[model samples]
Structure formats: structure tokens, C-alpha cells
Target: MLQGWGIWALGGVQRIGRAHIFLAHVLLGLPGLLLRLRLLVREMYVVGVLSMLLIAISGLFVGMVLALQGHNVLSEFDAEQSLGVLVAASLVRELGPVVTALLFSGRAGSALTAEIGLMKATEQLSGMEMMAVDPIKRVVAPRFFAGLLSMPLLAALFSMVGVLGGYFVGVGLLGVDEGAFWAQMQAKIDFEEDIINGIIKSLVFGLIVTWIAVFEGYDAVPTAEGVSRATTRSVVYSAFAVLGSDFVLTALMLRGE
Candidate 1:
């Protein structure tokens, strides 16, 4: 049992080292990414545009639920007027980036791992190597850059749509005072503090999710089962990383306050 534990520990450390080296390679390829602008745009469409519908729908329902629950809770204190502030703050600061990243990981991140893993299984990467074409630069970098670019934009959209959904439920359905809703939200929410912090969180989550996805794919054993396992690992690992990092980041941000 002790030997097994030691082997597992060593394997984990080695995997982490390989991931860091993979990240370095991806970063080193960034300069050449601009020359392959078309590839980046295509990946942006694949990961970003395709994922928007899921993000928007999830945001809408999440906002509605938040407003409903918040209304019920605040009404106990006779403070239903603060519903807008509650919804906006919750979505902007916490839910927006975190939920969107989780969804992105399940959706686009898995796709990335499977796609790249299959490429490796099919010997495409090996073919590129034989042709003196760097597959990391030609393939992985664009997808990585796309995830970084798409995540914050998607998070912003989720927050905006969620706020609107809250308005729809709070003001239209629950008879919340529209003036109080928008007014309190405007008054209480700080752009730099809430919004900027959310953006930063989304960017960090983007980096984590994309990095894990690409590395898993690149490291996958060249077989169908390996690709499937890699895809599963990408989602599972991304979730753990996002949630753990979120706690750390929230603590740091609160301290800064």
C-alpha cells in the first residue's frame, strides 16, 4: 500500500511537470499565432459562438431562479426592493464567470481534448512532425488562444442576460418596483470592484480550462480509448481546478478589499 501510494504521488508530480512544460511550449508558440489568424478565428467560432446559446439559456434560467429566491428571502425582512442588487451582485461577482467556465469545460473543452487526441491517434501530429511542421503551433495554439479570448466575453454576456432575466422576473412577474430595481443596482454595484474582478476571474478560469484541455489531448495515448479517457479527464480536471482556484481567488480579492 505504501509503495502504491508512492507511485501515485510520483506520477502526479510527473504529470504536473509535463503540463507545465506543455504550457511553456504553447506560450512560446504565441508569436506565430498571428500569422495563423484564420485558424484562430475558426476555433473562436467553434468554441465561442457555438457555446453562446448554452451560456445564454443557462444564464436566463439562473437569473430567474435567483430573483425568485432572493425575493422570497428579502421579503421576510421587508427588503424586497434590494432584489436587483442581490441578483446583479451574485451574478456579476460569482455565478457569471464560474458557471460559464464549468459549462465551457464540459462542452468545448471536452471537444478539444477528443479532437486533438484523435489527431494524435491518427498519426496526424506525427505526420506534421515528419514534414517539419510543428503541430503544437499549427494546431494547439489557436485553440488555446481562442479559449482565452472567448471566456471573458461569454461571462460578460451571461451577466448581462442574467440581469435582464432578473428584471423580467423581479419587476414584471413579482411586481418589484422597476425604479428601485435598476436604481439600487446602479447605486450598490461598483464597476471596478465587481465587474473587473469578475472579468479577471473569467480570464483565469479560461487559462486553466484551456490549458488542461489542450495538455490532456496532447498527452493522450494514441488510441480510441485513450482519446475518450482524455476527454473525460479534461472535464473532470477542469472542474476541480476552476472550483479550487475560485475559492483562492475570492479569498485574495476579499483580502484586497
Candidate 2:
């Protein structure tokens, strides 16, 4: 169904399957999210630590580009001062969550699939089922909550980087006044809304990554070939889901605004 002629079929199947997985993620994440605060904390550390180099490296370039792009466009209008607000808004609402989600999808999503697929190959899940432990709650649930907790942390980190990128580009490179950057940021921004939007987007993205990974792993066939197929599918589907959801959320948010 991945072929061009089967695109519609693939979309429909993916949508239905994704919806089921999404619902599972939310329901699973709620109790797990509340009860697994300790795991959440640890997962935060792992995600933040694992992603720090990425967040910083990506963020630095992101910030530089945001400012560079803003300068080019706003300069045409002679409204260079809008750079700060533009960067702030763009990072908070859009780039922050989208970029973080893609990164998380690549890093965490593939890892989750491989780990679970390995477990399946080793019969760990069958063993768990035989032992009467709920595999979903015991295994998938923690990771689910972990993704939920990690999304905002990652997004916030990216936004910070993006904002700093703007700062360096605006002030250090462009010679914009420092106070003016902050002042413009404060003047045009609605922190509550932007923050909430960022969180909401992250939450959905977290759910998407976790669900795709788990589904692919659980469905993996036997032998190394099956594992490889599952891994490839995990990355492909997770990336597609992230981009599709980002577009959907952006459209919905824009329509509301």
C-alpha cells in the first residue's frame, strides 16, 4: 500500500490504525503519567541528556537562521524590530514542537521499536503474558508516559535555542538593541497561549511517536528480516505522522485564531 497507486488505501489504513494507537496512548498515558512520576523524572533526565547535544547543536543553527530569514524579510518592510516577536512566535508555536517531535521520533521512536522487537524475538512479551503482568502497562506504559513528559521538555529546550539564535543573529550580528529585542518580544507575545499550544502539540507528538513504535514492534515478524522491516516502518510512519499532525494542528490553531 505504500506504492503511488495504493496511496489512498495506505492513508486510510494508517489513519485508522493511528487513531486506535492514539487513543490507546492517551488512555494508557493518563494513569501511567500520573502514577509514574518517578519514571517521568528519570525519563526527563534521559531525554534531556540524550538530546542535549542535539538540542543545542540544532538550536544554535535554528536561531541563526530564524534571525537571518527574519532580517531579510522584515528588512524589505523596514520593520527590523519585528524580528524578536517573529522569532518568539515562530519558535513557540511552530518550530519548537515540530523540530523536537521529529528529533524525538527519530531517536526515541526507533529505539523503542528495536527494543520491543528484540524483546519479541526473545519471547519476553510472551513470557510477561504468561506471568500475568500486563505488558502494555508494564512495558509500553512507562515509555508512553516518558514520551509524554519528554515532549514539552524537548520543545522548551528547542524554543530556548531558537530564541537565542534570534538573539545572536539580531543583536550580535545585526546590531539590534538588546532591550529592543526583549521589549518587542514582550509587547507582541501571548505567553499563556503560545506555551499551551506548544504543550498541546508536544503531547500529541509524543503520543504519535510512542504509538507508532509500539505498534510496529508488536507486529514485527520473526527473524532479523522482520525486525529490520519493523524498524524501517517505525521511522517512516513516525516521520509521516509527525509531519501530518503538525500540519493538522497548525491549521486548526490558525483557524481558531
Candidate 3:
């Protein structure tokens, strides 16, 4: 049992080391990305634009549900008018970034892992080496930067659409005072405290998800089964990382408050 534990621990350490090295190689390619703006734009389209519908639809339903539930609870306290603040604050401060990251992981992140893993499996990545081209720069870095840049924007869009959905439910359907709802939300939501912190969280989550996805692909065994496993690991690992980091980030952000 002890020997088995030792082996597991050593394997974990080695994986971590490889991830760090992979991250370094990916970062080294970032400066050159500016010169190849087309690559970045193409990836942004794949990772961001393609994912918007999912984010927007999810945000809408989530906000509608929150409005319905919050109205029930707040009504007991005679605070139904505060429904807007509740939905806005909940979505903007927490759900916006967290949920967006989770969705991105399942959608774009998994796709990235599968795509890269297949490249490796088919020896396409190896082919780049034959031409003296850096696969990390030519392939991995654009997607990495695209995911990073797209995350915050997607989070913001989620929050915005969510707020609109909440408005539809709270004001149009539930008959919470329209003016009061918007007023309370505006009065309570701070630009720097709520919005900026949420953006930061999304950025961190983006970095984590994209890093794991690319690394898993790059390190995958060059076989069909290996690529499949790597894609699955990408989603699972990204989800865990996003949740864990969210708790730490939330604690730190709320410490002052």
C-alpha cells in the first residue's frame, strides 16, 4: 500500500512538472501572436463566437430561474422589488464567470483538446517539426490566447443577457416594480467591486481551462484511445480547477467586504 501511494504521488509530481514546462512553451509563443493576428482572430471565432449561443441561452434560463426563486424568498421579507439586484449581483459576481467557464470547458476546451490530440495522433504536429516550424506557436498559442481573450467577454455577455431575462420575469411577468428593480440593481452593483472582480475570475478560469486542455492534448499518447482519454480528462480537470480556483478567488475578493 505504501509503495502504491508513493508511485501515485510520484506520477502526480511528474505530471505537474510536465504541465509547467508545457505552459512555459505556450507562453513563449505569445509575443509572436501579435504578428499573426489572423490566426488569433480565426481561433477567437471558433472559441468565442461559436460558443455564444450556448452562453446566451444558458444565461437566459438561469436568470429567469433566479428571478422566480428570489421573488418567492424576497416576497416573504417584502423585498420583491430587490429582485433585480438579486439576479444581477448573483449572475455578475459569481454565476457569470463560473458558469461561463464551465460551459467553455465542455465546449471549446474539449474541442481544443480533441483537435490537438488528433493532430498529434495523426502525426500532424510532428510534421510541423519536420518543416522547422514550432507547433506550440503555430497551433497551441492562438487557441490559448483566443480562449483567454474570449472568456471575460463571454462572461459579460452572460451577465447582460441574464439581467435582461431577469427583467422580463421580474417586471413583465411577476410585476415587480420596473423602476425599483433597475434602481436597486444600479445602486447596489459597483463597477470596480463586482464587475471587475468577476472579469478577473473569468480570466483566471480561462487560463486554467485552456492550459489544461492544450497540455493534455500535447501530452496525450499518440493513439486513438489516448486522444479520447485526453479529451475527457480535459473537461474533467478543467471543471475541478475552475471550481477550486473560484472558491479561493471569492474568499480573497470578499475578505475586504
TM-score of each: 0.99, 0.85, 0.98
Residue-level lDDT tens digits of model 3 in 1-257: 99999999999999999999989999999899999899999999999999999999999999999999999999999999899999999999999999999999999999999999999999999999999999999999999999999999999999999999999999999999999999999999999999999999999999999999999999999999999999999999999999999999999999967
Runs with alpha carbons beyond 4 Å of true place in candidate 3: none
Those runs of model 2 whose alpha carbons end farther than 4 Å from true positions after fitting are: 1-48
The model with the greater TM-score, 2 or 3, is 3
Where does candidate 3 have its weakest 10-residue lDDT segment? 248-257
What is the Cα-based lDDT of residue 245 in candidate 1?
98
Q: Between prediction 1 and prediction 2, which has the larger TM-score? A: 1
The lDDT-based order of candidates, best leading, equals 1, 3, 2
Q: Candidate 3 has what TM-score?
A: 0.98
Pairs of colliding residues, candidate 2: 63-165
Task: Compose the digit string of candidate 2's lDDT tens values, residues 96-183.
Answer: 8888888877777787788778888889988999999667666766666676677788888889988988899898999877888889
Off by over 4 Å in 1: none
- Better lDDT candidate (2, 3): 3
How many clashes show up in model 1? 0
- Scored against the true structure, residue 94 in model 3 reaches a CA lDDT of 96
RMSD of each: 0.7, 3.4, 0.8
- For residues 1-257, what per-residue lDDT tens digits would candidate 1 score against the true structure? 99999999999999999999999999888889988798999999999999999999999999999999999999999998999999999999999999999999999999999999999999999999999999999899999999999999999999999999999999999999999999999999998889999999999999999999999999999999999999999999999999999999999998999
- Candidate 1: residue 249 lDDT (0-100): 95
Candidate with the greatest lDDT versus the true structure: 1
Preferred candidate (lDDT higher): 1 or 2: 1
